[model samples]
Target: MNDYLVKAVAYQNQIRAYAVNSTATVAEAQRRHAAKPTATDALGRSMTAGVILGAMLKGEEKVSVKINGGGPLGTIMVDSNAKGEVRGYVSHPQTEMEINEVGKAVGMNGLLTVSKDVGLMHPFVGQIPLISGEIGEDYTSYLSKSEQTASAVGVDVLVNSDSTVKAAGGFIIQLMPGADEEVLNIIKDRMKVIAPLSSMISEGSTPEQLLEHVLGSENVTVLESMPVRFQCQCSVDRITNAIISLGSEEIQDMIETDGHAEANCHFCNEFYYFDTEHLQALKEVAL
Candidate 1:
């Protein structure tokens, strides 16, 4: 199924929940980046979290999660917006490790740091140390410390030995201000039978379906639903601007020595080539 997410409120507007099944979405990243099992798991969870958080924003506003885990995977970056668009990449996509006791990839290290930068009246940045290299723990840490809210986040990704994603997705639940004791107790009770989140997503279930299972169908209300996918905003023009930014000297060097320069986007790895003539033209503009 195509990857999509849903946003809604439950428990009579006492809880905010987000759910998404990103099997195909994460699969695309795995295929494109050729990520190893552990890297695939990390990237998949971060992107899933990016989509859920992206749903919380409004038009032209978005959030970015940068995880510098200082592992073999290096940095994992995710970009997402309220419109349900998100893109991400890991610095090194090919790194393998053993699965943990709960079938979660233990990754290169247990250390991670997830940070969020929001564009508000004044841009704000918040960060938290990851409790588990498993992204959900890191995100949960971010919300509790940075946003100062009680949140439960679960992200799951199952990869076959061949490195294809078997399932990928996650859920985020936030307790609103003045949440009562009954609500907390209800959530704890429901957590008992929810199963691994990605498994439900892989079974061709929708985000709404997952939430209905978690919060009881009677109390669920869909506020909005959107079709989201693995999207990248990079383009040839952006690469061109980057090339131009290198100043005239660099452009001249490429024109004289290499005949042309090929630029690869870090996000998509799509190659952009500037032939010698194009380089000379850009240099003239720089002059």
Candidate 2:
């Protein structure tokens, strides 16, 4: 099934929740970054969480999720927007580790911080101790502690030892205005019983299905569904603009030695080549 996300109101609008089926999108990231099993699972969970958060914004507003795990996986950077576009990269995608007791990747020993920069609004920032070095708990901690919104977030990523994406997906549930005690209890109970996110997504369940299970079929109303993908907004022209920022010295060096410059974008791994003529053209343009 195509990767997609859904926004919903559950328990008669007492709660606001979002869920997503991001297997294909996460798989694309795993392949592009060549992430190992543990790294793949870690990065996939981050991307899934990022995608759902992105769906909560308005036009031109975006959220950037950064996890400086300080692990072999290094840092994970995700830039997502309201349009269901998500672009992310791991500082070290090739890292891996043996499965732990839960059959999940081990070695998270790191903190988590997510900074959401929405255009001109001073950029909302949230930080929390990395509860599990797993993406979801960190996000849950971030929301409950930093954002002051009681929330439950579950993210699951399954990766094969061969560096292949087995399954990946997640959901975020937030208590809305006037959320009652009973609603919270119902949500907690459902969250406790929900299946591993990967198992559901891998079985071809949509975001709606996941939410239905979490909120109970009778108490949920699906609002909107949008396609989500691994998207990057980097181009040769953007790279050229960045090169111009380097000033004349760097430009001259490239023109003199390599005759051209090549930059590999971290998000999409797309390389932008700046030939001598292109550099010269950029040099003449006014800042």
Candidate 3:
């Protein structure tokens, strides 16, 4: 199914919820980055949650999530926009480990930082130490510490034997300021019995269905839904402009030495190749 996310409120608007089925989106990232099973799980979960978090913002806002856990995956970076577009990459895409070793594959010794570009002179930056190296709890901790909001975040990814992602998705439920103890207790009780997020997605649950499972069909009122996809804002023109900014001398050196230049986007792994003629043209426009 095409990936999408849903936003809702439950129990008379006492709780705010966001759920997503990001299987195809994560699979795209895995294919672009060539991430192994463990790395795919980590990157997929992060990207899944990141897109939901982006949806929480208003117009023109964007978010960047960085996870550096001191493991083989190194640093994992994901960028998302309020429009439900997201792109991500891991430093060590080939890293793999046992299913039970998810935390070990993404070490718990570093930090998970989130920076938001909310149309301000200065962007908001919040970070928390890796509490579990599991993407879900870490995001839960981030919201608790950074936004001072009580939240439950469950993100997961299931990989097939050949290292392809079979399913990827997650849900985030937050208690609004006026939420009561009764509503809280009800949600807490229901959460304990809900199926795992990845398993639910694997079973063909839509984003709305995921929320229904977590927040109850009777109580959930779907507010909005949007399609989500793997999107990167990198292009040959952008790369060419960057090369031009490096000055004519540098451009001339590239033309004389290599006869061609290649730029790879870290986010989507797209390659931009510039032949000597392209470099010469850029050199003419350089300062």
By TM-score, how accurate is candidate 3? 0.96
Residue 71, model 1: lDDT of: 64
Better by lDDT, candidate 3 or 2: 3
Local distance difference test values of all predictions, in order:
0.78, 0.80, 0.90
Top-lDDT candidate index: 3
RMSD, every candidate, angstroms? 2.6, 2.3, 1.3
Clashes of 1: 0
The candidate 3 region of ten consecutive residues with least summed lDDT is: 96-105
Angstrom error of the Cα, residue 284, model 3: value is 0.5
Q: Which regions of candidate 2 fall more than 4 Å away from where they truly are? A: 100-110
Query: Candidate 2 has which clashing residue pairs, if any?
Result: none
Q: On residues 156-240, what C-alpha lDDT tens digit does candidate 1 reach at each position? A: 8888879999998878888878776578568757877788887787677688888887888998888877877888888878778
| TM-score for each of the candidates | 0.90, 0.91, 0.96
Q: What is the Å distance of residue 26 in model 1 from its true position?
A: 1.0
How would you encode candidate 3's per-residue C-alpha lDDT over 36-146 as one tens digit per residue?
888899899999999999999889999999999898889989999999999999999998875546778789999999999999999999999999888888999999899
